[model samples]
Target chain A: MTAVVTGDLPVIEAPRSRRSGGGNGTNFEMYAWIFMRMSGLLLVFLVLGHLFIMLLLDGGVQRINFGFVAGRWASPFWRTWDLAQLWLAQLHGTNGLRVIINDYAERDGTRFWLKMLLYTSSFLVLLLGTLVIFTFDPDITG
Target chain B: MQAPAGTLYRGREGMWSWVAHRVTGVLIFFFLFAHVLDTALVRVSPDSYNRIMDTYKTPLVNLMEVGLVGAVLFHALNGLRVMAIDFWEKGTRYQKQMTWAVLTVFVAVMVPATYRMVAHTFAELFGSTT
Candidate 1:
């Protein structure tokens, strides 16, 4: 560990540095790290709250039929809760993955393609999850 | 630690974490696809759907669910590690430390969830309250 002195304070520079010379401008990664901690904390609540409500409330797991889901989604509260959960979890997870891809993929082409694949799949899942929540029909008359 | 030609593989903590995340993500995607398809069976016929869900009561499905939850927990925790490495210049040095931290969190969160899942499956299978 090499320590760089900044005004009588010891600052350690991380090894395997990605700090390229010039024009790399801005601490976007720092902002992202902060975002993860914040989002992860929030996800702790949102995800747990969701699981509790869906799997534990009322008559517990037995009550989670199609009708129950439909009834809950009919309310704006559940819808918003679900929408927020969907967006936050997906964004947080995707951003986390993006950082992973950037850190590992050394080749320009490899990094680019891997990220492309990641983003594409994230978008598709988000779209499908949202669609299912919104367009779900409780009544299927037979 | 020699990497093959044109592999672009880095022998580092971050690299392994990335590989794991990608692998788990793909696995989760496949599980999600199968889950959605199975649930769609409900639209076909409720009786058949209940019969299908009966299969999930087996120990095999319970074990798979443990693996699925493990995957989700690992990917989420490792994703946080990657974020830390990217964001904090100081964090990159502690990559090995953070990798361990991620594993600790994964086990902590997943162990309980896996237990509950298995217990529920067992209760369903044998029809015993105790």
Candidate 2:
């Protein structure tokens, strides 16, 4: 408000905007938003196909067991499919729940702690799932 | 408290679809957390893994699987509607229609899928493999 030109219609300084970038000049939220769409598009295929085979195809849930998993994972195709699915689904779900927490969890500390727990659990799932896919023992039935 | 002037979303098909999307997404996310854990059980003894999976094959749990398939199918279909709304030039103009289209496709896919899954559950529970 201080600086003004001599006669140029009383120049005024612009006030700061009410809205701000995520406090850090990075498009993190934008990326997360886009990631939801991208991963969601892929997951429609991965997950539904998975559901079809696991829940609708042959004998469905009745035939699912350790031997079935070992048989499926024996193929590289299924291994990669499950691996990609595990990663994409967890990350997509993590970002999604994070947004939900931000919206519904009114308290600042509550949101923070809930998100910490979410990240911890998501990380554990990802780690454990990846390991299982890689080191699956097809002969565990023996 | 009130949108006296007007609003784009107006609590109709669009708003309800948004609500369903969020609810199903959260539900599916929680399920996925548990699903990964169950799949990981294979790394343990087969006895432990198959023992748990035996529970999944039961009657009540199979019904839940039907519900799960419905939820996932809805989420996947409506997600495409969202993509259309976000990316297509005429999406906003036809969004309500697209929502209907999503549901139509959802039911179309769900009917046969549900039948097949339920048939399997019946056959398994009654000891007639087909």
Pick the lDDT winner.
2
Q: How would you encode candidate 1's per-residue C-alpha lDDT over A1-142 as one tens digit per residue? A: 3333334434446876665585468888778778777776676567656655643355344444555555787898987887787777777767866876787899999999999998898788787777766765656543
Q: What's the CA error at residue B9 for candidate 2, in Å? A: 1.1
Regions more than 4 Å wrong, model 2: A1-18, B1-5, B123-130
Candidate 1 DockQ score? Answer: 0.11
Docking class of 1: incorrect
Model 2 chain B scores worst on lDDT over the 10 consecutive residues at B1-10
Q: Which pairs clash (backbone N, Cα, C closer than 3 Å) in model 2?
A: none
Fnat for the candidates in order? 0.01, 0.69
Best by TM-score: 2
Query: Per-prediction TM-score, please?
Result: 0.59, 0.89
Interface RMSD of each: 9.1, 10.3
Model 1, B41-106: lDDT tens per residue? 545555555666657656786587567667767866776676677678987779889988998887
